[model samples]
Target: MKAAVHSRYGPPAVVRVAEVDQPSVGDKDLLVRVHATTVNRTDCAYRAARPFFVRALTGLARPRRAVLGTEYAGVVEAVGGGVTSFSVGDRVFGYNEGAFGTHAEYLAVPHDGPVATMPAGMTFEEAAPGTEGAHYAMAFIRVARVRAGQEVLVYGATGAIGSAAVQFLKHHGATVTAVCGTAQLELVKGLGADRVVDHTAQDFTRDERRYDAVFDAVGMSTFGRCRRLLRRASSGR
Candidate 1:
């Protein structure tokens, strides 16, 4: 098998395609022939070994895991005897920020992990990029306990996570106020946001509408800045 591998942490130049031993299938593993994958921020963060903590996952001296990718879409070439959820020839796509091996010709994943059957009529390229961003977005929405009819504000609404957040919030029946740059205002609106704010032209925190949750997708805002925009709790019932 061949993979985009890096021995040391640095920029894009550090990685190269190299032959590597294919992963052995575990009792619950499925060996996928990767058809599509993505180069995402997580991969770059790990490659650069930025923020220091990333070293804990990769390596302190150098990268322990040479292949760096977290998302993939492909066909199951083989399935472990214990794996019944998926079988050989199943079209699947999924991601694991902790599992960085998808930028390769083959990837082995636990059948019960984040892996799922690809949606009908969707290509591998389309499904491959869906998991990483949507996973983070869904996590935030779940943590916030966002519900139908709730008002939620999303900052950095044009980003991968933010774009998914807008659509997910709308799917949950929330009234979303999305904040993005001027160029992405229409794109965010097309994602089903009830209102869109041009952060480049005006500050979104100054908006009048109180929100049930403020999702800073790009990690640019602090709690102190958006606290005033939150709906205050009151004694009721």
Candidate 2:
């Protein structure tokens, strides 16, 4: 199997495509012939060992794992003895998350992991990135306990997580306000945001409009900066 492998932590130049030994399936694993995968922020973070703190998991001096892709969409080539959920020829899309080995021609994932049958009418490339975006967006939505009819704000609403957050919030019936660059205002609105704020033109925090929850999907804003926008309990005065 050929894979994008990186031995040292640095820039994009550090990674190279090389023929590596294909992974073997475990008792509960499925061997997938990867058709598509994504180069995501997590892959870059591990590649550069950014924030310096991430080294604890990636490695102190070098990456703990050679392969760096976290999400993949492909067809099952083989299934392990205990893997009854999926069989050879089943098309699936999912995230490896901590396992991170999708930047290759093949991947071995536990059948019961995040893997699921690819949705109808979606291509491999389209389905791959959705695993990461949807997973994180769903996590944030659940953590905030978002409810229908509540007001929600999504900052940096154009990137993977941000875009997914906007759609998810709207799907839950939250009135969504999305913040993004001017070029993406219409794009965010197409994702079902009730309002779009051009971050380059105005400061969203100064709008004086409160929201049930504020999600900084891109991590571009801090909680302290968005606190004023969060809904406060009425004093009944």
Q: Candidates' TM-scores? A: 0.94, 0.93
- lDDT, candidate 1, 152-175, per-residue tens: 999989889999999999999999
**Which residue pairs overlap in candidate 2's backbone?**
none
Find the number of clashing residue pairs for candidate 1: 0
lDDT (CA) for every model shown? 0.90, 0.89
What range of 10 consecutive residues in model 2 has the weakest lDDT sum? 228-237
Provide the global lDDT of candidate 1 against the true structure.
0.90
lDDT of 1 at 193: 92
Assess candidate 2 and give its TM-score to the true structure: 0.93
Segments in model 2 whose C-alpha atoms lie over 4 Å from true places: 234-237
| Model 2 C-alpha lDDT per residue in residues 7-30, reported as the tens digit of each score | 999999999999999999899999
